[model samples]
Target chain A: MVKIYIPADTTACALGADKVAAEVALQAQKRGLDVELKRNGSRGAFWLEPLLEIESGEDRFAFGPVYPGDVAGLLDAGLHESSEHPLFLGRVTDIEWLSRQDRLTFSRAGVIDPLSLDEYRREGGYEGLDKALAMTAGEIVEAVTDSGLRGRGGAAFPTGIKWRTVLNTPSDQKYVTANADEGDSGTFADRLLMEADPFQLIEGMTICALAVDATQGYIYLRSEYPKALQVLNQAIAIAEAANLLGSDICGSGRDFHLQIRVGAGAYICGEETSMLESLEGKRGLVRFKPPLPAIEGLFGEPTVVNNVLTLAAVSTVLAKGAAYYQDYGSGRSRGTLSVQLSGNIRRGGLVEIPFGASLRELVEDFGGGTASGRPVRAIQVGGPLGAYLPESQWDTPLDYEAFTDVGAMLGHGGVVVFDDNVDMLEQARFAMEFCAVESCGKCTPCRIGSVRGVELIDKIGKNDGRSANLELLEALCETMDVGSLCAMGGLTPMPVRSALKHFPGDFERGTGNGIER
Target chain B: MHSSGEAPAVIVSSAVRKFADTPGGLLPLLHEIQAGLGFIPSDSVVTIASGMGLSRAEVHGVISFYHDFRDKPGGQKTIHVCRAEACQAVGSRQLEAHVKTRLGVDYGETTVDGRFTLEPVYCLGNCACGPSVRIADDVFARVDADRFDELLGDI
Candidate 1:
């Protein structure tokens, strides 16, 4: 029987993978051809989504952008016949887009049956947990610490230290929470992992639990991803049945129970404290600092709060050992980044590469530049809070410190590319507007300052207040930066400020077509 | 609006009771009630407040606070247009204008026939495929004016 593969990743599905899959099945059934169809995750070469791979001998043959209308033609063309169809790209492994990637976190994303526990294990899945189970709690924390695995949720806080803090904190009941609320506009890695490799996240969380001695865990997922929520919930039930979750894991007698908590439509909930509040069924308002989430989180208990990627990376850390995972990257960012290339990019997709890869490599090489075939003006390399880097700063390496040196932050590794046609002032105004809407109203600087920021940006656009207005806008941003409780307002100044700095011409260009004040 | 608020108190009580044992159950309970009745009625708020042993003010605060919960029910269909940076990069701002112009309603308003309600969505996590729209649980991507019209035409 010929084996057929279709990407079930949301990115692919959004691009009509389901239709292509169904068409393949229908065509095969009609022709009475023996075929096995499996839904795999995306290969991350999104330009070629609905990418059909055929099993022939040891290698999988690649074909892409295959639609429902093209399926019958493909079947007639003998897709499995030595990768020799018109759409064929020879070996799937040699596809340079994927071949160039250092897929530590997303290794299993496009390779196996997402829900099949057996396949996951067969492809070196449980090795991480197995390795972790043999080590002492201190040893496990030490391994993570040695790996230099910072929080992938943008803060770059040392994950090992956070776990150590949780482990040291004396509490009757401790909890481990995965902040899966990926609310960033250009980010979908958390959602992808949940949908494609839910077990990786589970394993990572389990490792954290064992390390921290927290038996109970919760993953606060964003509700926008209903498909991810469904897939993760199913995977959880499967893990529970398989003894990977719940009490008595792998006959070790150590208990770890994980649950899914979906967030309401609040972007601020992605913040750790706000997420904890939302988990407790309250409004996702940012809690004051002094008592960090590591010290006191989720019901006033010391909680191990790590992002989905941070926990998922743990699987690689344990499975491959500290040095193996650490050897891949340069600088303090000592691992591969699952870069989400989005927006106006031509070949926008997930690019998992070592940290030293420059921003130009991601936008120009991996992304294939702007979708409109126009010159790329600027790119936002992170979620909404990240600064917009102009073409001049595109030389900066994708490492955390590199971005910071350019007054930018790689919040969640989501790079949103923009063409020359983009109006930076409008983009700046949208940032303030987004902040105003998503703000929990917990702090006046974020709440009121954001509204003021919008008004000031609009005034500058209309050429109403000119230089002083820009100065006032800068002052207001400073106030929010210092006074705001969390990054929602604090870092919003990033895009606003970056736009002002890099694209000053766009600010005054809006004067002719005066936007309503 | 989706389903009518005929038995809002009953809906609220059942949901509240179901989640009574769960900690921080109020938000989920409120979500359930909203799902059932389309909008949480004043009567349901009182019912939930009593069931959760909270004040009406508390219940109202929560309902009004979250963007998900609606004070009044919308039209038969809710067309949530993506308005975030990714979507904006691909002309979602223009898409928003087109949607409003075509529907003859603003972002938060319902069409005169009660067939469509336009809502501004931040991001639906379909970033790679920009200009995503969510009509109920199903999220459609790369939605232009033509796609938008085609989607709402039958409904």
Candidate 2:
């Protein structure tokens, strides 16, 4: 029997994978061949999406961005005979973008059928869960702490500390949450992981549920990620069917059930407490700290809120042993960071590499430099709230401490490359504008400060430099940094100040220092 | 004002209907409507509001709040150029300017020919391949001015 899988992800379907799958089914039926079709999640290679995988002999032959019209020809060509088909000529494993990665978090993604528990089991999916079930909750937390796994979401907080906090908290009802709301621009690893290997996230959360003694878990995903929600819902159903979820998993006395919650298209919902508020069907508002989410989170109970990558990474660390994950990265940041090499580069996709790889290597070797073949100018590591780095800093090793030393953070390992034609002044303004738009309007500094920031950037851009504007903007940033409750308001100055500092020439070019509004 | 009873029938597809039927279905419902109709039309605002037990004004507010949603119908083709930090680092702004110059329209505006609508998307998850643009649904990453023109010519 031959099997064919077409990714059901919105990105893939939009590229005509659905139509291709239908055509394959129709063609197979017409020929009366024993062919089974499964709709899976995206393979994460956006450029090669609508990627079709056909079972041949012992291996799966891949074809991609395939249209319905090409289905019959592919069938006629016999996927078995040609290992060097235009699509599979570059084998999935051989692709540099995927080949170099230490794929712990994304190990099973794009390989297993997203909805199949049997396949997931066969592919060593829940081995971590099995190990986790055997260990005591404290032991599990210790193992994670020893592993040095940090949150892959921006901030890169230690995963073990959060789990330990939840474990130590006293509560009858505790909750585990996987933050799938990856609203970061130029980032799709969360969406891909959720869609392609939902079980990894589920297994990771299930492990958290056991460790934290949480009875319920929620995968808070963004509304824009429709396909991830669909896959998660289906994966949840399959897990329930397999007794991996619901009351008494694998007939164990422990009871854990998981659900999926979609966030209203608000970027701030990525914040752990805000996600909790949204899960309760209220406005997505940021909560002040001192009682971090791990201690008293999600309706005032103990909660273990983690990013999708953090949870997914937990599975790998638990399954392969802590040393395996601990051995990968530089100081403080452990395990392979799944670098979402995106934006203005030739080979854009997910590449999981050891921490401390130079930014130059990532930008030049993996990213293949700027897409336009223009001279590379700047790069933005992390997300929108991250700092903009010029060419001089390209040699900086990509690790948490190294980035921090340079007044930047290794936020989510999403590196976006830019070319020389970009205007630093405009890019700086956009950061403020995005902050203004996505601000929860909770703090006066963030709400009004962001608006004023945008205006100041524009004024600088237009050469309306009344040196006073620069001073005022800097002062506003200080207040927002201290006064704002969340990163949304706090980090707005990163890009603005960096742009002004790096490209001072751009500001002083047009306007007199004494020029007024 | 058009009579509520005599308003155009907001015929939702089975996918949209299924989404709208779920509890707390407003967000997904809006997403489905946008996916189907390009933008949330005035008719959809009323129908979705009624179906979800939300006020028309509330529905409209939600639709208008997000940058992804648009009130006016988009052109036949939607050109989404990534204007995120990464793309901007690679001179995507210049590419954007060139595109605007060629298309004779600013960002978020449709061409007079109804063939293209240019939008400035923050990112399309193509950072390693910056200066990426999605024409309709096809993402063209690492695109230069020449490649962009070639792509435009094809469409």
Candidate 3:
């Protein structure tokens, strides 16, 4: 029987993968061809998504961005035999976009059936858990520490230090919470990973539980991802049935129970303290820090709070050992960074590469420039809160310290490109507007200053006391940056400030057609 | 606007009973009630507050704080338009205007016929393919003005 594969990923489904899969099944049945149809995750090459693959001998041949209408024609053109077709791209492994990537953490993504335990295990999934089950808590923490694995959710806090603090903190009932509230606008790595290879996250969280002595774990996922929510729940049940996440794990007599806690639509909940508060069934407000989450968290107990990617990388760090994973990247940033190339780019997708790669390479070489075929003007790295880099700064290497030196951040590794027609002043105004809308109202600087910031930008755009309003906007941004309780308010000024610095012409050329107050 | 004949108190009580044992059950309870009843009815607030051992004010605060929760029922179908920067890069602002003009409803407002309610969403995680929109649970990508009209016609 010929084997056929199609992506069940949300992006692919949105692009009509479900319809294509249905068409393939219908065509096979009509022809009386014995074919095995399977749903796999995206290969991160989203441009070629609904990417149909056929297993022939040892290699899987690829074709795509396939639609239902094209399925019949593809079959007529010998799709089953992987013959000449316009959509066909030969072997999947040889695809240049995927072959160039250093897929350390995303090795199993788009490669195996996400929900199949047998496929997951066959692709070297449980080896990390097996190794972790044998190592002492201190040894597990030590390996992560040695690997230099930082939090992948934006903040570059070392994962080992957080676990060590939780391990040392005395608490009878601690918690391991994975912040899956990936609210970043231009980023989706967490959602992709959880949907494609959920067991990886589960295994990573289990390891954190054993290391921190916390038997209970919760994944605080955002409501935007309904598909991911369903996938994770099913994955957890599968793991439990397989004895990987129950009262006894692999007959080790240890315990780790995992559950998914969906977040109501509050972007502030992406913050650690705010996420903890939401987990406690509160208003998802940002909490004050003195006793960090590691010291006193989740019901006033010691907690281990790590981002989804940070936790997911633990599986790789354990499976490949510290030295093997650490050898990939440069400087303090060890291991590969999952760069999500998006926005107005021609070939936007997820590019996992070692740190020290230039933004120019990602945008121009990999992304193939703007989708509109226009000259690139600005690029925003990180999510909504990240700064917009101009042409001069595109050569900056994607390292944590390197970005900081240029007043930018490799935030969540999201690079959103923009063509020359973009209005930076409008973007600056939107940044303030977004801040005002999403603010938790915890601090006056964030809540009030954001509204005032929007007004100030408007006044500048109208050219009414332009210079004075610009100065006032600077002062307001400074206040929000220094006085806000958390990053939601504090970092709100990043995009605004970067726009003012890099694209001053847009503010000067504003037609005063700003968003309605 | 409790259009359903079922009593809000009964719906609230059942939701409360189902999630009362779970840790931090308020959000889930509220979610269940909304899922079953379409919205969290005003009269059920007191029942929910008392059942969960909290004040009515607290329950209201939680519901009001989150964007997902609503106090009243929306239109028959809800259309969430992505307004974030990534979408903006690929002409979502134009799509946003087209949606409002075509539906005769602004963000958070229901159409006159009660067929659709337009809402603004920051992102739907399909950034690679921009100009995304979500109608109920199904998210559609590269939604230009023509695509939006075609999708609306399907409904």
Candidate 4:
């Protein structure tokens, strides 16, 4: 009997993994081949999606981007053995991209069956929770603080301080909420982690509950991720049955109940306070700070609100010691950065490396430049709100302070590449339009300023008052930057300003070719 | 346009019974009703508000706030095209234009034949493959104008 592996991840399914799986099964049966099929998660090398793996003895041979049409030929070409086929890639681990990545959080991502408890346990899944349960709250917090792990969800806040705040707060009922509402574009690490190895997140959240003395936890996932929702729910149930979660967790007297709450397609809900509001069944509106979710949150009780990556890294921090995790990166940003390479690129996928790597290495070497084969014009780091960097800024290291020095942000580590065909003026306008459409309408600068920002860009594009409109647009960006209550309004100017500064010629050309609404 | 054939009230009551008691259950309740029926009927608001101890205005505000919820029924199928930067970098604008022209309907509008409803999504998280589209639960990647038509034909 031969064992075959195929990915059931959303990206793989989008690329026709399901159809490929069905065809493989049918062909194998018709050919009278003794084959056992297993559905696993993606290996994050998306270019090789629907990546079929055939396990022979100890090693797994790979075939890539396979479709339904490729299955019959694959079976005939000695699919069971490591045969020479057009799609065949040598041993899965030997792929340069997979071999180079320092995968700490995504260690079990594509290696294990997502829902198989036995497989997850074999790969060091719940060992973190076991170690966390043995330590006191202060020791757990100290370990996290020593790891120097900051929030990966854009803000770059210290994770240890947030946990310490929640631990020190006295409350009858506290909460540990994972911000899985990953609304940023060119980013899918949170979704990848949840769908691929959900047990890691569950184990991480359970460890958090043990650290903060929180009784309940909620993963505020966005409505866009239906697959993640299903996988997480199943994983939670499996963990509960195994005594990993519930009233008495893992033979301990403590209780921790976890649930999944789906967001209603609101991007602002990615904000921690807005997530708390949405969890309460209200419109996702941003709240004032100072009562920080740590002191007074989630039903007026203390809470530890963290990003998906932040919480997932907690498992690694506990299982391994703090010093072990802290030794990976440069400066304050420790641990691996999950860089998501997307947009017009020859090879776009997830690249997890330690901090301090240059952006040019990721775009040119790993991404293999543009898919269109045109000269690269710009690169947008972060999301819609992030700045657009020209070729000169590509050498900047991927760190929080390094990106800040270059007037860009490593927001969620999403690097979207664009060729020379792109229109910077148009991209700047879309940034304003996105802010206008998705703004929660809590602040005037974000609410009114964004709409006006769109109009100002339109006027500048048409050359109607040209210089005047440009000045007005700059002033408007400043107002939104300073007056807005949250990053939603404040960060709107980053892209607009960067576009104006780097690609001034696009505005001067005055084609007025605006995107159709 | 009520595709499920069950009364909107029945769907609303069932959803409320399942989620109303839970804290912060309104969003889940709304999702259930939308899943059962095609959309959330305005008449169901009063019932949901009363069940959850909220006002009708509060309920309406929530329904209007979210991009996913709709008060009126849509076409037989809803298609969401990603409009985020990653998709845009690989010609999603061209795909969007083609879809609008082919369907003869703008976003949030159903086709005359009630075959498809066009919607715009920020990101479907399939960033590696540009120009992603979602129909029902399935997401299609690297979709161009031609592939989109082929997908529509299959449906």
The docking quality of candidate 1, as DockQ, is: 0.70
Q: State the lDDT of candidate 1 residue by residue for A1-517, as single tens digits.
A: 9899998877788778988988888999999999999998776777788799988887788888787888998889887646466788878889888898988898888888889999899888989999999998889999999999999999999899999999999887899999998989898888888888989999999999889889999998887888898889899999999999988999999999888887778899999999998888777889998699888898999998899999999999999999998898889998888899899989888889999988998888888888889999989878888899998999999899988999999989998988888889889999999999999999999999999999998788778868899899999999998889999999999999999899877877545642332
The C-alpha local distance difference test score for the whole of candidate 3 amounts to 0.91
Q: Residues B1-155, candidate 2, lDDT per residue (tens digit)?
A: 11122323443444346755564455666655566666667766666667666787877766665556677877878787776676766667779889999999988798998888887776665454456787765666557799889888877
Give the per-residue Cα lDDT of candidate 3 at A109: 95
fnat, candidate 1? 0.66
Better of 1 and 4 by DockQ: 4
What lDDT does candidate 2 reach at residue A291?
88
Show the lowest summed lDDT stretch of 10 residues, model 3 chain A: A508-517
lDDT at A326, model 4: 98
- Compared to the true structure, candidate 4 yields what TM-score? 0.98
Candidate 2 regions off by >4 Å?
A1-6, A19-40, A50-54, A61-78, A81-90, A508-517, B1-155
Task: Output the lDDT of residue A450, model 2.
Answer: 92
Across all models, the iRMS values in order are 1.2, 4.1, 0.6, 0.6
TM-score of each predicted structure versus truth: 0.96, 0.81, 0.98, 0.98
- Which lDDT tens digits does candidate 3 get at residues A1-517? 8899999998999899999999999998888878899999888888888899999888899988798999988887876544778888889999898998999888899999999999998988988899999999999999999999999999989999999999999888999999999989889899999999999999999999888889999999999999999999999999999999989899998899999999988899999999998999899888899789999999889998899999999999998899998998879999999999999999998999999999999888899999999999999999999999999999999999999999989879999999988999889999999999999999999999999999998888788888899999999999999999998889989999999998887887444543322
Ranking by lDDT: 4, 3, 1, 2
State the fnat of model 4.
0.87
- Across A306-416, the per-residue lDDT of candidate 2 in tens digits comes to 899999888888999999899998888788888887766766667778898999998788777766788877787788988888877888998999998987777887787
**Residue B127 lDDT in candidate 3:** 96
Which candidate would rank higher by lDDT, 2 or 4?
4
